[model samples]
Target: MAYDVQSAKTWSPGDNAFYLIVEGTTQEEIKEYWEQLITDGEILQPLAPSQWSPLYGMLKHQFGVVWALSVLNDASPM
Candidate 1:
């Protein structure tokens, strides 16, 4: 599927408020993504177990877009 592209003023890295959410089925998968991000992008936060509810972590994409990745395990109440 194709989507429309909008033209706007370019923003500096970590300047925009928009972010992305990437969901996975396991912590390993999330870790893999984190590793890839570290190699290609930047790590906003290290890949560690979340202190709150379900297991999750946040990182910045290669294009400066923030990504909140999570593992939706069955053990999670949510």
Candidate 2:
């Protein structure tokens, strides 16, 4: 996919690196961000329990920005 070429053309690594991997301290926080970004986007991966974290998911924004969201709990270290 040409995500790097599709999202905010003016944006640079200094801005967002084109791909966002948000690690929230709480499930609610990540979920909040997920719900908002996914409004007009696509859910590449549904949110669910993963070996790496309590919750994890992947999605692409309407404009082509890819997002990886998850909860950063004590049990996980990423």
Candidate 3:
């Protein structure tokens, strides 16, 4: 599957923070993307594949933005 940064926005101190959610079909694919993000960015939360679910993780982009990445399998709730 292909992915892209859909859009971006800025905020103030009191305003809500922004989070980009990336969904992928498989854990390997998402993990590869996560590694790329790590090479150029910083890891907020190390990649964790849930025992009860598929996968979930967080990272801070090089552009000073936060992103939540995940891989959803057929058994995933969302």
Candidate 4:
């Protein structure tokens, strides 16, 4: 079987590893995306409000690797 390497809203492929970052003005969008990922069995972790903040959360899907997600209050850094 072929392994599928997918990423949740917060996850991305970089640094030779999979990382998740849920930021920007799309917290709700990201949450919905994550919900879909869970429903699809792509993610094995439940997202908790405390995982990151009331505004966001971070988690690794299927591997407990690590990911970051949160509300984007400021964009000056970018």
Off by over 4 Å in 2: 1-18
Alpha-carbon error at 74 in model 1, in Å?
3.0
- Taking all chains together, the TM-score of candidate 2 against the true structure is 0.71
Between candidates 2 and 4, which one is better according to TM-score? Answer: 2
Give the TM-scores of the predictions, in the order they appear. Answer: 0.60, 0.71, 0.66, 0.42
Candidate 4 local Cα displacement, residue 16, angstroms:
13
Which prediction has the highest TM-score against the true structure?
A: 2
Instruction: Order candidates by lDDT, high to low.
Output: 2, 3, 1, 4
Q: Tell me the tens digit of each residue's lDDT in model 3 across 1-78.
A: 223343464454332255677888888888888887766788877788775438888788787667778888787665
**After aligning candidate 1 to the native by TM-score, how far in Å is the CA of 24 from where it should be?**
1.0
Model 2 lDDT at residue 68: 87
Candidate 4: stretches off by over 4 Å: 1-18, 39-54
Q: What TM-score does prediction 3 earn?
A: 0.66
Instruction: Please list the C-alpha lDDT of all candidates, in the order they appear.
Output: 0.64, 0.79, 0.71, 0.49
How many residue pairs of model 2 clash at the backbone? 0
Off by over 4 Å in 3: 1-16
lDDT string for model 4 (49-70, tens) is 5433445554454444455555
Clash count, one per candidate: 0, 0, 0, 5
Higher lDDT: candidate 2 or 4? 2
RMSD, every candidate, angstroms:
6.8, 7.0, 6.4, 9.0
| 4-37: candidate 1 lDDT, tens digit per residue | 2224745554454566666678777878877777
